[model samples]
Target: MNAKTPDTPIVIIGAGPAGMAAALALHTVGHTPILLERYREARPAGNILNLWPPPIKALQEMGVDTDDLGAPCHTTFRGVKGNIRADVQIPDDVVKAYGGGFIGLLRPELYRRMLAAMPEGVLRPDVEVTAIEDLGPTVRVSLRDGSSIDAAAVVGADGIDSMVRRLLWGPSERREHKLHIIGGYTFADVPGVERNEVVLRHDRTVQGTYSSIRDNGRDGIQWWVLEAWNPKAEPPADLKSHALSLARRFPGPLAALVDSTDQKHFQRWPIRDRKPLKRWSKGRITLAGDAAHATSPYAAYGAGMSIGDGYTLAQELTGVDLTDAAAVVAALGRYDDRRIAHTTAQVQQAYVLGKVFHHAPAPLRPVRDFILDKTPMLQKQVGEKSPAEIVAQLDEMGAGLVRA
Candidate 1:
């Protein structure tokens, strides 16, 4: 890729949750990893993230105090035409058993917190990785500034449109699901909105919700609108107008919130997920987070999975000789084996749930609502995980990783 370089055993691309977690993981194992990001600074405009317990626990182990950023929330689902469908409350006992609670925090705050947790100078912002070469014995990562670094291994933690993933698994191999989503956040004095509750309204192609949440000790609201539409159809230029148009069909308070939200805070983008790849590693190169398993937010597990990947990867590489190419390959193989199942299940579920949330054809709407309303168990199974099962899994994941 470039002239011979000093051995930087691991080079992590991207500074999002996955990359940051991987850096911390490697550091915990006594490896000083070089983390690179394309942006000049952190872009934390993804609105609020609903991080689950498993990943929250992992972040706590890495020294992040999520409790301050978020509080536990009970989720509700509304059917077509703003009708209540089902509600899923995370029981206190389950929260106590898992030792972590489901939380919502502004994505920007989480991003800043993660960067702050890293050692100074470990994160190289504004440095873009132009290319990567997985040499038989080493990985050469090229940067936009005509510089390169050789590492025993390279991590493709770069987001969905990951350059490292493209380098390893050609562009044609990448895939995206057919879903469109546009939404944003704003500070509002929503009188009736409960601070500890988030709601989702599934109304045909227009499916979304707005919730009151605590951010930096201030009250704020976050909202989103998702729809199953033509992938190639152009998105509306004015997201605020689009959200407002959809809001016309929403309940009074929900519509008012959308109408009152500032146009500057409205963000719009298509929801895309990568098709499950048969493999996530080649030679000394491996992928993590969105680069490995980009999923639709409908499942709300993608971020958690990314953080877990980094933690589990660190666990896998704990005592392995980084210079040993065979060991690196074997460790990555195991990482893929461990992660593929969980992420794949989430991807499939997100796709299925996206369909369920959107219009279920004219004749199926009533049936869909009936089942959703009658089946508390179904909602429970979808959103609630057994605390005992979660704790046991966490114990398994924490077993091999080096402690902080």
Candidate 2:
């Protein structure tokens, strides 16, 4: 077992939404934390966005201002086929009821806001962590720089390829991982689109959608995302060629939008998912965010879950007796248990949604429309009800989450 030269009380690996959020939570509880990251700075490739009701309220309490980079979008549009459907008129109060307002922001802008909230010396970037050794009560992390800082606990908030999770789980866990080099460039003055709304255009062989970013006071910038699922193959080498082909799938003014897009300005990312790890806590170390559980974008819960992980983990950690290692581990167990149920439901539902709603089926379109028409609450239930409630609803309806 590797041991550490005792350092900070807590050290979070990866300084993205989850890591930063964890630091913020620690600060609120009056605990100073140390954060480390391999990237030079926070990566804001995706249009930063969060839709959950709970965390928005927490952010308000934290007093972190994001008005310069974020906006409350009251209207949302979602549906399928060559049709317009499901226009949701969510009022500000209604949005707040969920937890916080339905807010959107640029990723860089949000990163800036999070940085301002933390104390100096807490955030460390551009340092790559190579390994984590579970040394009984605490974990000893070895960094590429050849120096290490030990902590009472280690957080695996690093994105999909988390180093902490790799060591703790070993290299053999069958958590299916895949990479997708998808890109999105910010564009101003996109025509025929409403702000604060996401518009999806379905092509039988492909799918296209544009979601609005928070108001930057200029013309709003929208992200056009393309997703293709292929498990065994590697991402294409020629990004522009593949991007152009992906762009061609969308007709109407979108072709022009894609043409106007700077493929070079686009953000590409690999995709990975864990089959709900057996446990998130091993003694004093625990997993948070993607390291603990990564969901497919089909659920759009990555950011939400990251924030939730930070929120709940903080709540549990602050309440637990930190002096007692067993007590600390138990508190983390609660964090893991809570996150697993919440995230697992999302992963399963997202896989089902990708097939049912995303796929353009001429035969099933009418039936889907009819089902949606009959029970708009099926979608409603998923959002308004708890995860346990969602499972119960599925049982009551004699329905089950679809498999990939």
Candidate 3:
């Protein structure tokens, strides 16, 4: 076998979906990569994540079975506000193009499943990375424990606030948004909301999502509220009150979900984003997933994009002359080139949706709701304006890996 770095393993930063998926893909290509995570272990957090179809094929290639991950189906989206409520039907063609539907699994369970797929001793927890230096032939990664190691290549899958991204592009190069989200899950399910549907509640200034998440043999309600505010503003000391304030605009079920949430389970996340970079690699160090391009949850493709990155990147590197430093750099470059456009579109779509959905003026709300109710445009907006093009990219990635 042709080893890219004969003496050193390719070091993968972060053990999240993207990093672990990268490890899985690299292993498929006969390369062993060590995963470093800042956390001690995968703990349960966040609500259900909709893993769309684009990345499901890549996940299957990496030995992940989407069937057992969660309920793989489309949850009907019911728009609610005041006395007005309407069901938003996604176009059948769009759903069919996406390869059936999505898996609305709990985020932590997905994390655990991906973690368990890795071979033993591949992941190191509680190892915080401090710095990374591109030393031409090898990349040097420094840890918080006053230790460092050299690798033939370094993959930055550390996520949105990626230290690797900061190291590579510096802090000034990154871009973020003002949309702040505070969310939590309740141990009890909300009445009136069906098991296979998600209710979207919105007012003039805020929106919330309510759905059911199954864990530990019982179903619980998982919900989130999005509101735009100053990034520098301090989060409210009374989280419950803050959450209610956002949910006040929403009607019964959403408010009830928030009220049922325990204080311990409440979490606030400042939704941040980064535009696609012209270049995601320099020498042997490069980035994948959120580390390279973090999108708003409006796109709902962040996890899928990151998971697909590992699959596609590994596919591009397979059969290449890894021993040749120049060839390795070129392979990394090709990975970036193939991903930039698609992920950029994802970022842009999410950004625009975030702006329009949460902050649209009162007068424009009618138009927005009318379009969502009467046309298939909303389906395209949530699913990509060019569904065929996105499907083609996903197909190419899957086909390329099969060839690998």
Q: TM-score for each prediction? A: 0.89, 0.79, 0.85
lDDT of 2 at 313: 74
Error of 3 at 236 (Å): 2.2
Candidate 1 clashes between residue pairs 3 or more apart in a chain or in different chains? none
Of candidates 2 and 1, the better by lDDT? 1
CA shift at 326, candidate 3, in angstroms? Answer: 2.0
Q: Worst 10-residue stretch by lDDT in candidate 1?
A: 383-392
**Candidates' C-alpha lDDT:** 0.75, 0.62, 0.73
Judging by lDDT against the true structure, name the best candidate. Answer: 1
- Residue pairs that clash (backbone atoms under 3 angstroms), model 3: none
Which whole-number lDDT from 0 to 100 does residue 339 have in model 2?
Answer: 71
Higher-ranked by TM-score: 1 or 3: 1
Residue-level lDDT of model 2, residues 31-91, one tens digit each, is: 5578888889877646535454444444433445544445555433244344544443444
Worst ten-residue run, lDDT, model 2?
Answer: 395-404
Off by over 4 Å in 1: 1-7, 80-84, 89-100, 173-176, 375-377, 384-393, 399-401
Instruction: Name the runs in model 3 displaced over 4 angstroms.
Output: 1-7, 42-48, 73-100, 144-147, 216-218, 361-379, 383-393, 400-404
lDDT, residue 161, model 1? 84
